[model samples]
Target: MTRPKTTPLPPTIVVVFGITGDLARRKLLPAIFDLYLKGLLPSQFRLVGFMRRDLSKLEFQTLIQDSLTKYHRGASSTSLKKFLKLIVLEQGQFDDPAAYERLGEQLKSLDNSLGVCTNKLFYLAVPPALYPTIFPLIKKSHLAKACESARAGTGWTRFLVEKPFGRDLGTARSLERQLKNIFTEDQIFRIDHYLAKETLQNIITFRLANPLFANIWNRGHIVRVEVRLLEQEGIVGRGSFYDEVGALRDVGQNHLLQMLALVAMETPATLTAASIRAARERVLKGLKLAHSDFKESVQRGQYEGYLNESGVAPYSTTETYFKINATVTTGPLRGVPFTLESGKGLPVKKTEIKIYFKNLKLIPVEVESGEVGNVLTFTIQPNEGVALSLLAKEPGLDYLVTEKNLEFAYATGWPDRLIPSDYERLLFDALMGDSTLFPTRGEIIASWQFITPILNQLNKLPLTRYRRGDLPSVS
Candidate 1:
């Protein structure tokens, strides 16, 4: 558990849009607090929370305090107080030009106090619809540009956008064009929090570092690859948003597909961001539906009583669950069936990738009824870890074989240290200008290209109904 040594980050200012939203309260604020506690943040850092809510400075501070207590427990009262002092809240509507003007002033005021032009990192915690409204405001106010006149143009500005980039390929491209107008591709960080997870990142290290598994990571040695992301809770108050995006666009296009790329991608020339991203882009560009017919390659499902949910259309055919059988048309995994499944209101909440290896031919020993081949699983949540299932001979007079699992849990393996949350890792990376964990524009477009056709045929596909706590049966 040796850690990499790193230089201290530069003085910075982080402005979070829609800071009053659920994502900011539950994840962003807490993660920033954790970084402060760990002394990983720069000493001259400032946090600006932009929202439409009309609250006093004290009230906003209280709100952040409550949020931190609830989402990120175990912080010392003294440390919490000190962190709150670094926060500044700006109340304004997204569409108001005056609000953007005031935001620019606030940023300038902070810089004046610090006597330096600090780097700016804007985190769009709001929905995708607000992006069009916000991006232009940022540009109009000169908030997207570096302060070249001040401090010899040492400062930089970057935007960290959340997932569900767009509804489909067409909309995604449109949004990309808008983003390009405001910021360069290098300055935009399209975040897929799943990619920041330790276990998912380990997939690359585990495969390449060990010759035992790396040699057999091709279609010749693997039977199939399954990526499952199931949740026990329904849309919960996001019915309006969920109804429009559905399961495939919400999770399948980004998280699930990214996982598949990591599993199917070839060894990178180096571990740098450019090398790894290039490898991932190659896999995504070659992905396609496994079958010619949509029905055979995709399955859609909705939880029973979904129509009764508030904000949901009476006859909405939106799917809360989807299972797609995709194939990598090129590379070592060409023609390999990669089943990607995700759903809400399932019996259990689990996220993992299972790689089923091809069965080995037995010649020297006679097997007495046992499952062959190995199943390598990388659990991404609930309990983050990796497990390998293998057949073992039972100790007895009679010959018997049983499936045994060799497992490693992060909690148990790293008992002495706290594992950073996904948002924490991602936010830190953005501040450090590390795009290694973030998906590139090419990756996003490639994923959308593969998903747009499936989305177009949703009308012809049948949506199966399942109980709230049951798994949907898919052929």
Candidate 2:
């Protein structure tokens, strides 16, 4: 890909919440450093760290170094040094009004001394429990007011919140209300990090731009849509939270559904961020989780438990895998059943969405023909790229056709440079105040509304089961 020659964004100050955590050290800082090294960071920018940690500036930079340097081998020392000097640390705790005030003063002092504008971006890298406490704290601290007073005209102040939007629709609604007090609908950036991936972003573009797909991307021509999010390993030590949320809340509600949304959304007249979100919002709002409604359309399962993996566990019933046969009620594909499949302990590592194209194969019939039709599969992980399988000549006698697969690998034909991690890319966007990759309020609300029914069903029925290392399927 050619380097994009574009003007830099307005100078901005980035405040990272939970700055000392794994997310900040591993992803946020590296992404920002990459942008800085690439000359993409604005000339007058400040990347501030906020959390309970009492690390000095040098110590904070060291924290980022220990994790990010190994992952971002391409980064230069000079760029990291420049970024570190611009970075600062401030201590703040949830529900503390004075801490927010002091943090605000730091932003003010930096703006005045550095001659930087007051555009501030707050990243809530903290847990959801901290959100209901911190949002009101920011509102009370007058950081929102500082955004108003900045010379840059309605000084840009936006907040980026991590996912697991809420436990259910009611809780999600409450969380939104908590944020509504301090930030406008547009001021909040809820991240489904998967949405920020290059290939994930390329989904609709790959399909809509090509006439071969746009013409037949409907129930009339397509038989089914299979969307999968697979991981080769188990939950590891993150079971404290994963046990409660399970696969549905962790990957199902957001990422898998997001892919389905992009595949199922119609061709909007235009593809602006707002327009595209509007299309997604329409699909989310129409979601009704009646067990009877989708008796055939939806399926859920959990992987073999940690305590019961033969000798892996003595005996346990906790599920680490799940599958859902979701039906979207929005866009041109409304009422269309999209198979949402994912597993925690799969046989191998693979994440792809297979689009079942109808009848392009000239179907196997008479003779020894082995035609199985055509399918366009978009793989987002492991071996990243697109693959298409279709019937082809067997190179033997006439009518001796056989099934053949063709793949276009994105990783193969790219530049030698490494692509930033999904978390890195998203954090960089937040720092630069580009909210296009983040999910909006409408999208979050719609997601919660769609997920509420599934949660209710899970609570009512707990035997959802699947074997370890088993592939995910609707059956």
Best candidate according to TM-score: 1
Please, what are the lDDT tens digits per residue for candidate 2 over residues 82-201? Answer: 667888788866667888888988988998886655577888888888887787778777776545454554367877888888888888888888888777776778888888777777
In angstroms, give how far residue 152 of model 1 lies from its true place.
9.4
Per-residue lDDT tens digits for candidate 1, residues 249-335, read: 889999999999999998888888988899999999999888888899999999999999998999999999999998997767778
Poorest lDDT segment (10 consecutive residues) of candidate 2: 308-317
- TM-score to true structure, per model: 0.96, 0.90
> What C-alpha lDDT do the candidate models reach, one value each?
0.90, 0.72
- RMSD in angstroms between candidate 1 and the native structure over all alpha carbons: 2.2
Best by lDDT: 1
Report the number of backbone clashes for model 1: 0
lDDT of 2: 0.72
